[model samples]
Target: MARQVQFDQLGGPEVLTVREVEIAPPASGEVLIRVEAIGVNRAEVMFREGSYFLQPAFPSTLGYEAAGTVEALGEGVTHLAAGDPVGVVPAFSMNDYGTYGDHVVVPASAVVPRPPGITAVTAAAVWMAYITAYGALIDEGGLKPGDHVLVTAAAGGVGLAAIQTARRIGAVAVATTRSPDKKQALLDAGAAHVVVTDEEDLPTRVREITSGEGVRLAFDPIAGPGVDTLAEAIAAGGKLLVYGALDPRPTPLPNAALYPDLSTSMFTMFRVTAAPERLRRAVAFVNAGLSDGSLAPVVDRTFDLDDVAEAHRYMESNAQTGKIVMTVSHAPDAS
Candidate 1:
């Protein structure tokens, strides 16, 4: 029997129920996946809480990206076959593949050839954060080499991806985290400097680190009321990108400092992934980046498929340094 994590009604992590679901064979241009690992993201947390872009239907399947072996191929599908290793990114919605399941059917566009060097757990976690970072920084933010990127929420998934991507392009990386503990870890991920904003002053610390030149780009996901400090610290004519407001409060832009000339770009990946070709490019970009060693999604910890509630709780705590993941296989025996 094919089993998956589902919620008859959306509310919290506890609402997720893992049970058997009937499997349908692939249609034209789709392929079936045997899930090895699934990524648990804060986006999943937001989806469960009904704050994400899409609302949950009763008994909706959960998960956006995963990786596994190919089980079957649909007609007209090229470059993939049964028994191949691949990453499954469920563009559009989780119902596209219901990747939390043991098996799923996904469009060819949603799949990428997962190289042997990358584990399923790492492959599943890399796509979303990396693609979102690539789109926001290079495609949208117009980041250039020698640019200084100040990334908020530096220990989180996007922050981790941003650090590696910035380093890949030869840009200076400055990452921030609430926990003073993850500072060194961020540096280990190739950050030029790691800022523990909860411990250090934001503007003053950024200025000190940048030697008062200020950063050329600020990639902010935490848009709390205090983000004016970020706006205050942005170097003249630099860009600011706010991808989300994880904080309950809204960011306040002081009019005096909020110059019309300041470039600020905002977006949701859901909107960007709508184009089938772009989705394919996202898959290609991440897969190539991983294969080349320039990008690797950090896996903080992996829980069993049955332990999704604990995974959600852990992610909700915001203490994890990188991607928190779930695997269909059993959790590793403790030491």
Candidate 2:
């Protein structure tokens, strides 16, 4: 039996529960892993509350990222072996397989060997955030060196990853947040400038930072009426990439009367993960960065696997400056 997190209905963090259940062996094209650490994301909270694009089946499993050692490999899976350190990518559907448990069986394609020198916690935190940022800024936005790109909600995992990814590509990263206390931390995270939205006007400040030309690209997660402000902040012919819906309200397109040259797109990491060639390039890019120390995963805090509900609560609190990780412990006789 393996301890796994599950929820039978839509609700808050309190809905999450841990249960010991029989684990299935790896099926063909799948591999079983003994999970050591798990990354917590805001998407899981949306999934639990029934607000995500993908809804859950009753008693649904919940997770997308994990790092562990391989325990077994199914037929046709020859690239990995027992005891290999590995990490789970968020390429597969959560309804099909989840990494919330101490042991999980996932598709062979979604498992990648952990790079040397990265711990389980760091490995668990890397893929989702970096890939999401990479897909939006590089793949979709066509971000280039010397160009300015805006990263909103700049304290979260993906936000910090976006800053690092931009810096790695030589682009100028302009970050935004609602709190003044996080300003210096965002600057320390490699952002060229930090905008505390609560204290300043976003468009005006962005214009000042860009010397009136405005940023070439703006990546945002809070989609709502505020999109107009972001739209106003972009240079003519620039693009706005909206990747999330943290605001939970209606979003509006910019008035053609104001900025007809502006372009907007809704982005998701699946754009890269769902495409074979894109996924390959993205993996190669991130691996090279990790191996060279150009990219680093930031883990803000950790919780015991049994305290997953609390982890979810913390994520919802919006106080975390980086990725929140959950550590899984296997008692000698529990597995």
Candidate 3:
């Protein structure tokens, strides 16, 4: 039996429980992986709370990112063999496959070889954050060198990834966070400027930073009344991409009356992964960034597989500056 995380009810972190369950071999177009590390994302919290885009069935497993060595390959899977180190992308739906287990089965299309010199923990953290950022800022926003981009919630994994991805493209990344304490850390993480939202007005600070102009794109996860502030901070003809709903409050629509030139839309990483050519471009772009040291996965903390609930609590606390990774330990399969 393989140890996997599951929750029968929709609720908080306490609802999650680890259990030993039989894992079947991969079927056609699938690959079985012995998970070494799992990346914790805010989506899982929303999923467990029954607030995500996809709802879960009872006793469902939840996960998106994982890194490990391939243990078995299903029929027609010709590219990978057993013992190859790899990472699983968040391309598949959580309801269809999960990686929060010592051993997990995932679609072959979701598997990518881990680049040399990156540890499993780091590998586990890369895809979701970087790909999400790339899809929004690069693919969708059309970010260019010397252009300014606003990155809100600058301490989370995706926030940090957006900063790095912007810098990698020669654009300026302006990071925003409510905590003044994280300012220096965000600056050190490649953000050209840091905006403390609690102390400073977002639009004023962004305007000052841009010398009376505004950022070409504002990448935000928190969608509520605060979106009006972001709309004001965006330049005319720019875009405001909202990729997540960290705030459950109702969002206000302020574009038509205030900033008609500004365009706003919701984004997800699946938009890039769903298209084959786009996925190929995203993977190649991210791999090149990783190989060249332009995009580095910053792991803020780690927890044992059994401490998943605590990890979830930590993520919900918003105390982390980057990715929270879960280390998995495997035992010899008796089968």
Best of the two (1, 3) by lDDT:
3
lDDT of candidate 1 over 24-117, digit per residue (tens): 7889998889889988877788888888877877678878888899989999998888889888664757544467777877778778788868
* Candidate 2 error regions (>4 Å): 332-335
> lDDT score, residue 311, model 2?
98
The residue-by-residue lDDT of candidate 2 on 1-335, one tens digit each, is 88999999999898999999899899999999999999999988899999999999988998999999999999999999999999998988889999999999999888888888879999999999999999999988999999999999999999999999999999999999999999988988899999999999999999999999999999999999889999988999999999999888898888889999999889999888888789888888888888898888788999999999999999989999989999999878664
Off-target runs (Cα >4 Å) in candidate 3 are 332-335
Query: On a 0 to 100 scale, what is the lDDT of residue 180 in model 3?
Result: 92
**C-alpha TM-scores of all predictions:** 0.92, 0.97, 0.97
Question: What lDDT, from 0 to 1, does candidate 2 have?
Answer: 0.93
The residue pairs in collision within model 2 are none
For model 3 the TM-score comes to 0.97
Model-by-model lDDT, in order? 0.81, 0.93, 0.93
Global lDDT of model 3 = 0.93
Compose the digit string of candidate 3's lDDT tens values, residues 174-245.
Answer: 999999999999999999999898899989989999998899999999998889889989898999899988
